[model samples]
Target: MSLRTLMLICALALPAWAHAAAPKPLYRDPVMDGAADVSIVFDKGRREWVMFYTNRRATQKDPDPADVAWVHATPIGMATSKDGLAWRYGGLAKFPAQCTGQTLWAPELYQEGGVYHMWLTVVPGVFHRWGEPGATARIVHLTSKDLKAWACGDTPDLGSDRVIDASVAKVGDRYRLWYKDERRGSRIVAVESPDLVHWRPLGDGPVVDMAAEGPKVFRFKDRWWMVADAWKGLIVLRSDDAKTWTLQESRLLEQPGRQPTDTAKGQHPDVVVNGGRAFLYYFVHQSNEPQAKADPYYGQRTVIQVAEIKEDGGVLSVDREAPVEQGLVAPK
Candidate 1:
């Protein structure tokens, strides 16, 4: 072949390498800097991936000693990505004020029947401290046609007013929703629904008998996996039947990575399985960094990260230091 033709062929094959690796801190909320509890969904209409996260006011200054309002009265922030590697900050989601409250936390998204559904943790009003009188969190269901202009829907009664961080997955013919029940020692619990509206408790008690929050359940590598933020590290569990789960011996993202803004333990994971590959998107606080030492409030700042999940012999693991090579494949 001629040298000119050979060079043209090589350039054509370079498209894969043309896309950059996933950034160290995949994304950060431009406004608040407290992006947590990410829920990633593919926007079929827009042909991109959308990330919804908790936008905590981590930059708040001169707050009262007892005031926890920085974490409260937050909105669900949005970010969009064309290839799931490079993301841009989209504005906050718009939920009907009449249906939602001042405080919004973890948002879980599921799509069916050409409609998008979100299960959001809502606290009626901002509070001065945690567990203040009448301070309660509940999950509310909302539906949107275009991922904007959400309309209120039914609220599944999981028999708890102190529930948050919802994770939903379809198992068999029914949909299973897993969330943290703070009233039950912050243990992860679940409820099932044939449709998205009505719900019933899944089993006798907590699915994974551990004090964890931000439960994320998904099917990957021919097995059902559940990962939750256990404050120390992410607890991993595997199940043949999405109902009964076996806890893995090792935790993920437990130790700090050498990357910037990822020195602390990862929290609040959201998993996306595409084309037989799974990618984990989690948030990490900068609490252990020198910046936190200079400013006490710097510890409150958090950023989103992406890592490829690996499974071998029925065991799951993630190397946060490795570059993420898998880009999300558009839904068929």
Candidate 2:
């Protein structure tokens, strides 16, 4: 072939090379190998994506009781990525000594007033199974300037004995927090604060119906969106006033074509919106489902996944089976 024709052929093959070289659709914790209840925030100072999650011990098999082991004490897992998809485990978060070895649940990361704030669910008594009579859970506020070197604060009393999965968002001049009140049938409820220290209940009823947890709220476009883990799938709600909400008819996490067979429901979703593009981040347990049983690390182990959120005729949807690239891509 002539040199010019060869150059054209090479140019034609470039697209094929790019297509075949697309990054694999997977993200996992290399250290503990168990990542759940994931939350992501951009680190502008570090110029990368930082993920904080529940770092469960994947290799720790359940003892005779089975229930207690799964709920054992854990630290908040940390990972960093240049792009949001491929991750490198940065190790567990280093909190105050009091929080060491305590079961740290969903971590809600928010930045305000030049400080990085984290609302973490702290559960006492690791030996007791979840929902045990003596086990107590609370949400504590933490602050870090660099997402490292955290300062712990007292747990805010939300008029509940058992609360977990705290998510917060700032609207106008006030801050709003939504969390699961286990004292009230594990339903998701909301409270507001002007300074994020003292919170008052929004109303007498739960913001979301019973049987859901991990309430996350974010502002995208012109409306506010809230998502909760409903055990079966993710329950979605939208609000214009940030108080009254209407549930979306379709559940997000129960789509049938999930890879690795998401037998268990997707829990604790944190939505990251950038430049009018939204990406939903959540984790799925690697159960003994048909697609996961073949892997040696099945059961108890969980991996994080991200999906692009799209709106069609005012309805939002995600295809869990769609491949995610290594770097974050915002929709045009």
Candidate 3:
């Protein structure tokens, strides 16, 4: 082949190379610097990637050591990115106070028929500590035509009052929602919905029999996968049929990474599969670092990070040490 022709062919193939290096510590909440539980969706009208995350009040000055208020009374924060590398803070999401109350976490977003649907973890009121009397968590449904303003919908009966951290994906012709059931040993469970309104338990028991939270389910490599924060590291599970899941031997983001603001374990992930490649977006704390050890409050801060997910012989792996290639292509 002629040199010019060969070069032209190579140049044209560049778009097909789906993997690229993404920015380390991809995003942080500019307001409170406590971004977590990310849900990424492509805004078709705006033609950009939008991240909806929990905006914890980590910047509160000199919080009481015993007080857990910093984690409550949070708003769902938003950020936008054109290429999923450089992100711009977009502030908190707007929801009617009557329906959503003061605390929101783990914004799980799904789009169907041009409407955006969110299954958000809502706390009735702020509390100073965990497990305080009358503290309850429930998942509420909301719908939006544009990503900005949301209208409240029904809160599905998930058989638990302390349910939180929702992850939704369409399985076959039905939609499946998975979340943490804290009342049940903090295990992960599933519920199915036909029209995104009513829901019922997928089976008699939890999908993941381990103590985990922030379960995210996605399809990649022609198989269904679930990744959940197990407090130690993110656990991986695979399934040929989205309904029956088997645990993978290894976990992801369990070990610390050698990056600024990413020295701790990854938590509450959002996986985006684009252009035949899968990327895992997760949040990391600074608690294990030197600075955080000196100042305990520094550990409250968290940052979002992204890494490419690779599969070989049906095993999924991530190299946190390697620079992530930016491979987020716009969805059609």
Candidate 4:
């Protein structure tokens, strides 16, 4: 081969390695922007993608602090589409009765033994304004043997404090539940449950703790990836044994957005693998306000987005396309 030929080959390969190509956004939920905490469910039977999330009638830190208890949030909302690209809002799903105005948050729906199991943040006091000091936020899960009639079962007590945004993933035979509890600093903690209701603490209660919140997990390259948001930025940690994990980088990815409407402060890192490609769906809260002021991290409320997840062994960031999508969160 000629030296010139070799030089030409090197030049052609430069673009592929120059900077990893960003993944494409498949869908962005309008509700969380008005929509919050969106989850994506792929209906294999119908070959469709179902999007579910919380449609807040008002935010936690609304203009009126009293609205926190008064503004009745629309119950857990749902939308469906043939592809993840198009979504038609399906309105609210079943809300836990007796908990008025408690439009469910963190409605994570996953298939368990041919049934759909949903675990969500149930702030009962906010719904009723009971003013129950510690009984503010809780993680209550339910199961639907047929996706129709549901039954609430005994789950773990996230402490009466404020615990929300629960993400559960099945790693082989055991179940892993990740949630944010300021009860222990705004970090993600993991709990193990054999029956999916009762849980056992794995690794001193929190397997991964950061100055962040909203933890979700996805499996790729035959390994478990734990994604969480912290003051530093959005980080990804990998685990093979389910209990012990490794942080790929202190800062795995960062979303730069300057405006209140643009993608900033990425949270709720959700990933969807489709058509031999992977999409990372992250919730971007407009970072215009102090990070503390931002409910989830430091933005406006929370908006759902879809992004492409790059698989290059140890590094990945969101590839935002126009009208960018952060990725998939059946529990988003």
Q: List TM-scores for all candidates, in order.
A: 0.95, 0.87, 0.92, 0.73
Q: Deviation in angstroms for 180 in model 4?
A: 1.9
**What is the lDDT ranking, best to worst?**
1, 3, 2, 4
lDDT of each: 0.90, 0.77, 0.88, 0.62
Winner on lDDT between 2 and 3 is 3
Off by over 4 Å in 4: 1-33, 44-46, 58-74, 98-103, 127-135, 145-148, 158-161, 250-253, 257-261, 286-302, 321-332
Q: lDDT, candidate 1, residue 293?
A: 80
| 1-332: candidate 4 lDDT, tens digit per residue | 99999989988886332433223222334544446566677655555576777665533455544334432344676777654554666656764474323446767778755677777777653453433445556777777654445777665765536777788887778898888876786667778778787787766756665556667787777777877767456777888866687876645346555433444655656666655566666655555546535454223355565656776766665545444333232322
Question: What TM-score would candidate 3 get against the native?
Answer: 0.92
Error of 1 at 54 (Å): 0.5
Residue pairs clashing, model 3: 20-325, 20-326, 21-324, 21-325, 21-326, 22-324, 68-128
Instruction: Report, for all candidates in order, the number of backbone clashes.
Output: 0, 0, 7, 27
lDDT for predicted candidate 1 compared with the true structure = 0.90
Give the per-residue lDDT of model 1 (tens digit) for 6-96: 9889888875625579987899999989999999999999999999999999888545645788999899999999888999999999998
lDDT of 4 at 7: 89
Q: Which stretches of candidate 2 lie above 4 Å from their native place?
A: 1-25, 99-101, 256-258, 261-264, 289-297, 329-332
For model 4 the TM-score comes to 0.73
